[model samples]
Target: MRILLTGAGGQLGRTLIDRLPTEWDIHPFTSGELNITHYPSVKHRFLNLRPDVVINAAAYTAVDKAESEPEHAIAVNAEGPALLAEAANQTGARLIHVSTDYVFDGNKSTPWVEGDTPSPINVYGLSKFAGEVRLINTLPDALIVRSSWVFSEYGQNFVRTMLDIGLQRRQLSVIEDQIGNPTYAGDLADFLIFLAQKPQVKGVLHFAGNETISWFGFAQAIFQAATAICPAYASMQLTPISSEQWPSPAKRPRNSVLCSLRLAELGFPSSDWRARLSEVVPQLLAANVLKKAN
Candidate 1:
C-alpha cells in the first residue's frame, strides 16, 4: 500500500514514519517539503503520488502564539485539512487526520466521548475543531483521531521540557488543574497503523494513554522516571500551581481527558502510560546526559 505521510519532521509524524509496517510504501514529507496550507503544492503531490492512504500529521501547533496569528493558524490547521480532504476525495485515498483534545472546553469532569459538543476555549483549539468540521464535511468517511498531551524523544514537548527544566533549576512549577492523558507518540503511531488496516474504522475516535493525570502529576512522574538515569533531575523542587497562576494568551481547558470507548470496542489494546513513559524516559535522559557531555 502507498502511504503519503505529512508533518514528517514532527514527533508523531517521525514516529509513524519510523514504525509503520515495512511492507507499506511510505512517502514522508516535512512542512518545508509539502506546504499543506498551499493548495497547489498539496494538490500536485496528491495527484502525482495518488497514494492509497494520506495521513496528515502536519499542524500549526504553537498554542499561545496562535492567539496573535489567527489567520496563519486557520490557514494551516483548518484550511490545510480541508485541502487534504478535498484532494483525498478526488484521489480516492483514505485520509487519517490527527487532531487534539483541545477541541472541547475543559468544562466536563468525565472523559470526552466522540459525541460531546466542542466548545474550543482558544484560537488553537478552535482552529483544530474547525479543521475537523471541514474534514468531515468534505469526506464523511475520513478517519479523525483525536489525542492529547503527546510526548516523545523526537520533538519539543512537555516531557522534554520538564526534563530540561529539572536539570537547570532548583525549583519548578507546573499547572495542576489542567488534566489529560499523556500519550506517547510511538504508541499513538502504532495505533494509527493498526487503524489503517481496519477499513471499517471511520469518523472521530479518541486514543490516548490509559491514565489521566494533571500537569503537576505528569511532571512528578517525569522526574521520578528520569531520576533513575540522571541524579541531577532529582535535585529540582517541584511545585504545583493552578492555571490562573500560570496564565497564557491561549486559554487552556481545565480538564480534557478523552474516553477510549471506541478504541476499546475496536479491540485496540489499552496502554499503561506509566509503563510507556518508563521505556522512553531513559532514552530521553541519556540524550540529555550526552548533550551535556558534548
Candidate 2:
C-alpha cells in the first residue's frame, strides 16, 4: 500500500519509519519536504502522492513553549490535522492521526475512556484537543490514537533526559507530583501498524503503557533499572521532589493515565510498561545517551 508518513524525523515518526516494511511504498516526508501547517503544500502532497493511508505524526510538542506560541501550535496541531482531513476526504485516503492524553485534564483517577469529555489545563493540551476535534469534524472515519509520555531509545524524551542527567551528576531531582504512563514509541508504532490492518480499529482509540506512576517514581525506577541494565549508570542517585519544589511556566495534569480496555477489545495486546522500559534503557545506553556526548 502507498502511504504518506508526516513528521518523518520526530521520535514517534522515526519509530514508525523503522517499523514499516521496506516492501511497502512508504513516502516519509519531513516538514522541509512537506509542512502540514501550510494547507496548500499539504494538499499538493496528498494530490501528488495519492496515498492509500496518511499517518500524521507531525506536531508542535513543546509544552512550555506552546504557552507563548499558541498561534503556531494551533496552526500546526489543529489546522494541520484539518488540512490533512480535507486532503484525506478528497482522495479517499484513510487517516491515522496521533493525539495525546493531555486532551483531558489529569483529574480522573481511572483511565480515560474514548467518550470522556476533555478539559485541557494547558495550552498544549487545549491545542491537541482542538486538533482531535478538528480531525473528527473533517473526517469522521479517521482513526485517532490518544497516547501519553511517549519515549524511545532514539528520541529526545524523558528516558534520555534521565540517562543524561544521571550520567552527568551524581545526584538528580525529578518531579514526583505528576502521574502518567510512559509509553515506548516503538510499541506504539507497532500497534499503529496493527490497527491500520484492523478495519474495526477506526475512530477514537487509545494505546498506552500498562501501569501508571508519578514522575518521581518513574525517574527513580529508571535510575534503578539503568544501573542494573547499564553498569556505567548504576552509581548515580535519583531524588524525588514535589512539583511545588520545581516550578514550570505551564502546569501539567496531576494525573495523565489513560485506560485502554477499549484497546484490548480492539484486539491489541496490553504491554507491561516496566518490561518495555527494561528493553528500551539498554538500547538508549548503547545509543550513547548514557555517555551524554551530545
Per-residue CA lDDT of candidate 2, range 1-294, in tens? 888999999998999999987888999999889899888888889999999889999999999999998999999999999999999999899999999988888787777888898999888999999999999999999999999998887768998898878767887788887888888898899888887676556788888888888888888778777989767677777678888888887888888888775776666765577888888888877777535566
User: What is the TM-score of each predicted model, taking all chains together?
Assistant: 0.98, 0.95
Q: In model 2, how large is the Cα lDDT of residue 58?
A: 96
Tell me the lDDT of model 2 at 206: 81
| Candidate 1 Cα misplacement greater than 4 A, ranges | none
lDDT score, candidate 2: 0.86
Model 1: per-residue Cα lDDT over 197-241, one tens digit each: 887899999988889899999999998898887777778788899
RMSD of each: 1.0, 1.8
Least well predicted 10-residue stretch by lDDT in candidate 1: 263-272
